[model samples]
Target: MEKQLSKKIKELVLGFQINELTEALVYERIATFVKDEKDKQTLLRIAADERCHAEVWKSYTKEAVKPKMGQVRKWTLLARIFGYTFALKKMENGEKGATKAYDEISKEIPEAKKISEDEDRHERELLQILDEERLKYVGSMVLGLSDALVEISGTLAGLTFALQNNKLIALSGLITGISATLSMGSSEYLSAKSDGEEKPFKSALYTGIAYVITVTLMILPYLLLPSSMFMVSLSIMLLTVVLIIAGFSYYVAVAKELSFKKRFIEMAGISLSVSAISFIIGILVKQFLGIDI
Candidate 1:
């Protein structure tokens, strides 16, 4: 006869059961749209592992449990938006604590140890074959974003004090930003070509897109606000810069398994420092030149 689980152990086992089933559903759903055969196969295999885990837990719980459809939908939507690699990494990171739980539960149920080992294997497999396209051009994206943040943030800061007119600042920023985007794209293209990169044009396109998007976000406040609200617009623009840095940093951190805090602080610090210096220069220039526009 099988050993009966205690009430507390049974409840914990059932929770893991639900989690495993939900993840299985999520993986199966993601596999449908995945184009690569290898990647699709990996996802399906992991989904099978998840199902097996749920079954193992079910034997102990002595009852059936439903998959968390909400969690399934959430992961599915995240994968749609952010790509499967990020969503998978984020999901895996969320489940790290479960391994410890399984370890503790193994004393009551020997099968828990096997389930834990399977979980570790799932991670190894996913990490090995997760080849999302967007991740390939992260360097280009970072180049464009970092350059835009540093250059445009400083330009906007200087113009906000020097011009003192939101409309004028917006126009100036748009012209400068668009010109810089083209130049950066062309430069990246040439650089990639010289470096013998396989897809130079695509690299340049990614760089240009990242640059233009960052420029639009950074200059949006000035365009939307009144001339008298230059200070407010500048403040909002600066905050937007921080937010962009934070968001990009988070995305890269999750997708690449890097340090979020370190990247955020470094990028934010450089962009704000340049902006501060330019702001001071703007004040001094305005005072000396006596040009009030």
Candidate 2:
């Protein structure tokens, strides 16, 4: 029974080592394919780190009383067959899951706790790298789109309110929406190119396209509604509420150090403040500038 338990443990260790190697390979491929210089550097660093972890586990496997060499080669080949993109996503999911698994298993296997800690650290590092890389792309895309959507939507809504049933309100909304989409898309594309990072042009272009699409989608309702006393206002309020909820949820998820309630309240407060300020400015521009519908 004792021998069987030792064999089982050795197999588990070898399985984990194979996973580390697979992750290392995935990172290496990502490092090679990534065009952004910063992202490339980060991937290379992570690959190197994973390689070191594989070596550590290799050493442990060799020194163990009952060595169990699992299907490492087979698994590695299978991962390669799946292609780099799928493999990378798998590695990310595996790392995240392993972190939680390690945390749970550490309570029972005190001696293996060190290994678990190492896995946890590596998982965290990988997650951080992913988050940083995503921030560079995702945040910028979302910001450009959300900014245009809210600004244009709010402008059209306010104009409709002040105009008191002018058809020009819908026309202005269309003009602003198109202009904002073009301007924001161009700005995002240029900014991405200007960053001196060699990102996959297709990826960057897609992100820009997504930004434009998001802006257009958000502003479409305003244009679709016929000139009414309150439909535009209702649509604007609904969009604003959706944005607030989505934005607050993102803030809470990413704000690691802050409690959810605290982050929610803070983000909600800031959003409300910004909305109030924009509305007041809109009113003033209409009142003082004497802009005609």
Candidate 3:
């Protein structure tokens, strides 16, 4: 005799049913566009598993339900832009929480035990095998980003007060940033070559690209704005620093399953701290030397 499901358990089952079906469709759609044979097959396998899970939930609900179209489209588009690894990991993260929900429902229904296990464990292991180039070179990104934040932020802060002219500051910062980017890239290439990194050239490229992008973003305010409005430009530059730190930290957290709050605060704090110290130094330098730009 089948045990009767309570109202709460029934609702949970129905919701899971809808989500599973939606995700299955999302995976299938992404698989069609993927060029790699291994990747396509993996996506298809996951889609099949999702469909199986949906059927499991349907048995409890005893009702046919449509997938949530909005959710399906969102994941599909995200995968298309961000690549399958990020999108798949992001979707898997959602399933992590869903496993806990499934665990609770499993108390009333034994069949849900397998569903919870698959969601919590097996899916994660499967996703670990997916090759993601961006994640592989994340260390290079960190190196480039950290150096830019510390060096550029400090340079801008000190110059903002010392030069007191946006054009002068922008020119100086751009020159310094460009030189540093080249130097950093060259050093990274030589170091990686010596260390026997599989692709030294590629690593160096990532470092240079990251550094150049950061420099451009940091210098944009000074280029676009008037030289007289130094304070406003300075504030905007500072805000850009914070936003860059926050944004990169978030991307890393999602892709690598790291602590977002800890990473964000640490990077922001270090960058801002250096800027503050340099700002004071600039004021002292200007007053003591009596040099004005």
| Each prediction's TM-score versus the true structure | 0.95, 0.50, 0.89
- Model 1: per-residue lDDT, tens digit, 1-293? 87888887887898999988998999999999888788898899889988988898887787988999999999999999988988988998887778677777887988778867867886666666778788999999999999999999999999999999999999999999999999999999999999999999999999999999999999999999889899999999999999999999999999998999999999999999999999999999999999988
Between candidates 1 and 3, the one scoring higher on TM-score is 1
Ranking by lDDT: 1, 3, 2
Over 4 Å off, model 2: 1-3, 6-33, 36-108, 126-146, 163-168, 178-214, 225-233, 244-293
Of the two candidates 1 and 2, the one with more favorable TM-score, higher being better, is: 1
Task: List runs of model 3 lying over 4 Å from the truth.
Answer: 1-8, 33-37, 95-104
Which 10-residue window of candidate 1 scores lowest in summed lDDT?
121-130
RMSD of each candidate?
A: 1.5, 8.5, 2.4
Candidate lDDT (C-alpha), each = 0.91, 0.55, 0.87
Q: What is the number of backbone collisions in each predicted candidate, taken in the order shown?
A: 0, 1, 0
Model 3 clash tally?
0
Q: Single out the weakest 10-residue window by summed lDDT for candidate 2.
A: 63-72
Error of 3 at 57 (Å): 1.7
Clashing pairs in 3: none
